[model samples]
Target: MWVLVFFDLPTETAKERKIYALFRKNILKDGFNMFQFSIYMRHCASRENAEVHIKRVKKILPEKGHVGIMCITDKQFGMMEIFHGHKTVSANAPIQQLEMF
Candidate 1:
């Protein structure tokens, strides 16, 4: 499972800008990786774990621009197509197994 967060918060005033920074920091602190500007992704061990992170995001949500939270199966997340210009990068592949030392 994956918890994907997409947000656009107001930054018109100093206070609003502070809020925006705090929100971004909160998400990062909560273990989300930067997927793109204003977008983040966190891989969870299970659906229940994803729900926990989702609730944390909601707690720090701003009362301004739109903030979206979504959960997708690992298969769906693996289908993402990332490209830069004509070059393309494959989505993250799941580990087949972990070798013991």
Candidate 2:
């Protein structure tokens, strides 16, 4: 099981600080690896372990902010695909990716 965890605050001001603090306190406890900014993807030995982590995250998260967790199976960890204005671009083609002009 792959879990994608995201954290969002109500405002930009102080959001990074608060989120980072929460991340340090909660997510780091179980030694899970982060997948992206404000997102953590981890493989657990069992569902109980995942649930415990999620509960801990919920406990530490800010009351006013939004936190989301999604579980997906068999998804590549670093699969890259470019999208232009909601359109998917082939990875093999010479189309300019979003990172370049």
Candidate 3:
């Protein structure tokens, strides 16, 4: 499973920018990688794990701005097509997750 976070936060003021920075930092600390500006994604070992990260993101949501959270199966994520300008590009390989039972 994958947990994808999409956000659009206000940054017109210094304080707003700080909030934006903190939000980004928090998500990064939670293992999300930069997919694009305002978009972060993390691969989870299972749906339950993805829910945990989703909850964390919800807990730290900014008081002002739009945020979206999505969960996609590995197969669905693999179907994504990425391109740069006129050329096609491959999506980044999902990070290998180690599970200990």
lDDT of each prediction vs. the true structure?
Answer: 0.89, 0.61, 0.94
Q: Can you write out model 1's per-residue Cα lDDT over 26-82, one digit (the tens) per residue?
A: 999999989999999998878988899999999988888899998998899888889
Model 2, runs deviating above 4 Å: 10-19, 74-101
Candidate 2 on 19-97: residue-level lDDT in tens? Answer: 6676655676665566556676666545676687777766776666677977654334335465778999653322222
Q: How far does residue 69 in candidate 2 sit from its true spot (Å)?
A: 1.0
Sort by TM-score, best first: what order?
Answer: 3, 1, 2
lDDT of 3 by residue, 40-93 (tens): 999999989898999999999999999999999888989999989989998777
What are the clashing pairs of model 1?
none
TM-score of each: 0.89, 0.57, 0.94
* 2 versus 3: better lDDT goes to: 3
Let me know the TM-score candidate 3 reaches against the reference structure: 0.94
Give the per-residue Cα lDDT of candidate 3 at 68.
Answer: 97
